[model samples]
Target chain A: AQSVTQPDARVTVSEGASLQLRCKYSYSATPYLFWYVQYPRQGLQLLLKYYSGDPVVQGVNSFEAEFSKSNSSFHLQKASVHWSDSAVYFCALSMTNSAGNKLTFGIGTRVLVRP
Target chain B: AQTIHQWPVAEIKAVGSPLSLGCTIKGKSSPNLYWYWQATGGTLQQLFYSITVGQVESVVQLNLSASRPKDDQFILSTEKLLLSHSGFYLCAWAGDSGNTLYFGEGSRLIVV
Candidate 1:
């Protein structure tokens, strides 16, 4: 079974400061990775996804993620965060062979941007 | 553009009461539909998925059942609601690539 682990449960960063959320996955083979953001009482929105080549993938709102096959990790990064960036970010994994492309998500990291 | 909508926005019901939730997808046909459950401040767990109408597969047993009677509709229901079932229910559709999933606004349930 594929599982995602987000080490940080909560993160507090000052506005305009950089932020990084760590994510690690456990899978026998490389799986499709994704980053999603959820605001309060709202559904998740895809931030970005990693498929094949290019270790670094860019996403919306100046967000980016680096896929490291050797480390089994895909970490999300933002050089400067706005107060609106505060939300719960989830790291998800989807196996190519899984039925329906079921996604296994991390517990999510709640980000609070201090204004 | 494709859009997914989940009904009733939010609901509150007593324990052991019957419950039903509906989802509709517009502008897309024969799209894969999925039902996901999320506990308060927890990760999402896939409950059921349907590749086409009249065929539904259960990924986990949460005392719940899902069905797809129409090509663009998916339903989730249970005979008796449990307090543990109180959470956010999300309806999603897989993109053509089958790699990305687009989620609806979600339905929130509170079982007292």
Candidate 2:
């Protein structure tokens, strides 16, 4: 079966500091990868996605994710953090096969930015 | 642009009561619809998906059911609610040939 893993349950970062959220996935074949962000009381919003080509993809809010087939990882990164950037982040994976397409999400990582 | 809407932004009901939630999509036709549930601190779990009207597929068994009576509408309901059903319910739709899902505002359900 396929699954997503977000090792860090919670991360605390200072404002204006660089941010990185780690993600690992388990799948037999190349998988469709994605990064989503959820604000309090709000539904998730897509940050970036990787289907094929381009190891790095840029997304909204100055967020970017790098897809590493070798490491089986798709980590989200940002040059500088902002107060409003504090939220829950999720990593997802999908493989389009005979069963159609559906997403399997990771446990998610909550990031808190102080000052 | 495409938009998804979920009704009854929030609901509070007894454990054994009945429940119904609705979702509608606009600016897209024949889109793939899906129902996702999130526990208070858990990740998103797919409950059901519908590729076309009157055809719904279950992805998880949580004592809940979903239906797609119209191309743009999807409904999630349960004859008897359980306390474990309390959480956030999100509705999403994907474009044709693309697996990228767009989520709605979401509905918060509290079953006491």
Candidate 3:
């Protein structure tokens, strides 16, 4: 079974500060990695995804994630985060061979940007 | 542009009451539909998926059932709601088996 782990349960940062959210996955095959953001009372929206090629994938709102095969990590990074960036971030992984193509997601990390 | 919509944006029903949530996808045809449940701060758990109308697969059963009556409509319902069902329910549509899922705004349920 594929699983995802997000170490940080909560992260606090000041506005304009750089941010990094750690994510690790365990899968038998090369999994499809994704980063999703959920605002308060809203469903999650995709931030970025990596299928093949290009270790770094850029997403909406200047979000980017780097996929490392050896480390089994796909960490989301932002050069400068704004106050509006405060939300819950989830890292998900999907295996191609799985039934229903279900996505295993991390517990999520709540980001709070202090203005 | 494709859009997904879920009905009853927020609901507060007494425990043991019946429940039903609906999702509709527009600007797309014959898309794969899915139902997912999320606890207060937990990861999402897929409940069901439908490849076509009238055919649904249960990924994980939580005493709930899902039906895809139309090519673009999915419904999640239960005869009796439980206190454990108090959380968020999201509807998603995937282009393929399960690639990128476009999610609806979601429906929040509170079984008090």
Candidate 4:
């Protein structure tokens, strides 16, 4: 069984400030990691994903994440956050042979961006 | 382009009443479908999943069931609604080993 852990429950940043949300996973095989964001009254949207190759992956809204196998971490980062970036972010892990392609997700980090 | 659709954006049901939620996937064949529940101010929970037609797998059985009657349609149902069942229900579909899942608008259920 695989699981994900998000160390931070809430992360606050001021406008134009850099931000990073930490995520760690526990899986036997090479895990597929993803970051998703959810705004108020909206569904979860894909932020970025890391399968293999490059340790760092870029996503929309100037968001990026770096995967470290040694540390088993995939942390989402942004150079500068805006007030509109306030939302809940989730870290998920998926495996190829898993039944039904079920994904294990972290509890999520609620981000608050102040202007 | 692939998309998933879930009906009844918001529904209110009484305790002990029957409940049903529908989901449909487009632009893909034999895709993997999933039903997820999110409690108020809580994390997401996997409820059910369907890989192929008529093959449904239960993840968290909370007095609820899921069925895939057709290739593009999936249904979530329960015999009786409970206050605990009141939450946000999301429908998602994935292909190619669930690399990325596409989500629907989500259905909000309020058990009164």
lDDT of each: 0.96, 0.93, 0.92, 0.91
Candidate 4 - CAPRI tier? medium
- TM match of model 3 to true structure: 0.98
Give the clashing residue pairs of candidate 2, or none.
none
Alpha carbon deviation, residue A58, candidate 1 (Å): 0.7
Instruction: Specify the highest-DockQ model's number.
Output: 1
Whose lDDT is higher: candidate 2's or candidate 3's? 2
Q: Write the per-residue lDDT of candidate 4 for residues B2-108, one digit (tens) a residue.
A: 88889989999999999999999889988989999999878888899988999999999799999999999999999999999999999999855567787788999
* Poorest lDDT segment (10 consecutive residues) of candidate 2 chain A: A94-103
| DockQ of the candidate models in sequence | 0.94, 0.78, 0.76, 0.73
Candidate 2 stretches greater than 4 Å from native? A98-100
The DockQ of predicted model 4 stands at: 0.73
- Weakest lDDT window of 10 consecutive positions for candidate 4 chain B: B94-103
lDDT per residue for candidate 3 within B44-87, as digits (tens), equals 99999998999999999799999999999999999999999989
For each candidate in turn, the TM-score is 0.99, 0.98, 0.98, 0.96
lDDT of 2 at B91: 96
Deviating ranges (above 4 Å) for candidate 4 = none
Q: Chain A only: TM-score of every candidate?
A: 0.98, 0.96, 0.98, 0.98
Best model number under TM-score: 1
